[model samples]
Target: MSYQFEELFADIQKDNRKVLDDIEPFEHPLVVLLRKCLEEQEYMLDRLIEEFEEGKTELKDIKTNCSALFHANQKVNPYFAEWKRATGWIGYKDDTPSEELMKSLEERLDEMQDDLIEIAAKLDEEYGESTTKYFIPTFYLPEERVN
Candidate 1:
């Protein structure tokens, strides 16, 4: 099947609407909190990719960035780590999470997704849809996929 940008965009828009609806009415700080979390995630992810592509993916650098991103995210929204543990989003790790922690993480992910959508929209406007192209190719294995 052919790729469908319109469908993906529509899905993102729907998610944005749901995120707005689900947020607590008086939780005004969530907007900025989520924004910071998303921004850090985006920045760190970009750096991680650049270092990896340049054959400089040192464990120390990776760990440093990962820990910094995690801590920064926790500062703004502690729920991110909790949600990852609760939802098994930790991937290949076997860490048990409490119910309260899971709930908090779920809330943070919901908020963070909205902030990501906003950032993506801004990037798209500035750099065109090609902005997404920067990340997509990195998602695949170089040996298995054509450039």
Candidate 2:
């Protein structure tokens, strides 16, 4: 997760601007994918919060998990806000985008995972080692499960 700040800044400055004086930002194809990704992520977060609430978990535990999820998801918040602005003009569309589009979206999402790792590492390096866990927990794959 060796993050090059220049690379990310360049991505942000890509040619995705509003055509009209007060329009949205869907010029970048990645925005389409990001909108859907945000929805799915929010849905999952809702489910997790509901599960914890149903278990009669302590308030602190619920807050901790929910806050963690929100903070991690907010890493992509800027893109989500951009898509929402676009939707305000064009409403909700796209039940199914092209196969090629979907593939591109998947690739972008993979890149996002790398970005998350890099961000975590950067925070740890600048602040303290404990900062990484504060941002994101150590994840385990299905094969790595103790059970």
Worst 10 residues of 1 by lDDT: 1-10
**1-147: candidate 2 lDDT, tens digit per residue:** 212432432232221111111122334554645544454454544544355445543434433543354454554546644544554466455542344543444455455455445544443454455433453445411223213
- lDDT of every predicted structure (CA atoms): 0.43, 0.42
Q: How many pairs collide in each candidate, listed in order?
A: 0, 0
Off by over 4 Å in 2: 1-95, 140-147
Evaluate model 1: give its TM-score.
0.34
Residue pairs with colliding backbones in model 2 are none
Q: Which 10 consecutive residues of model 2 have the lowest summed lDDT?
A: 13-22
Best by lDDT: 1
lDDT for each residue of candidate 1 in 4-86, tens digit (9 for 90 to 100) = 22233234334434433443232334444654555565566555445555553344445455444444444544544433443
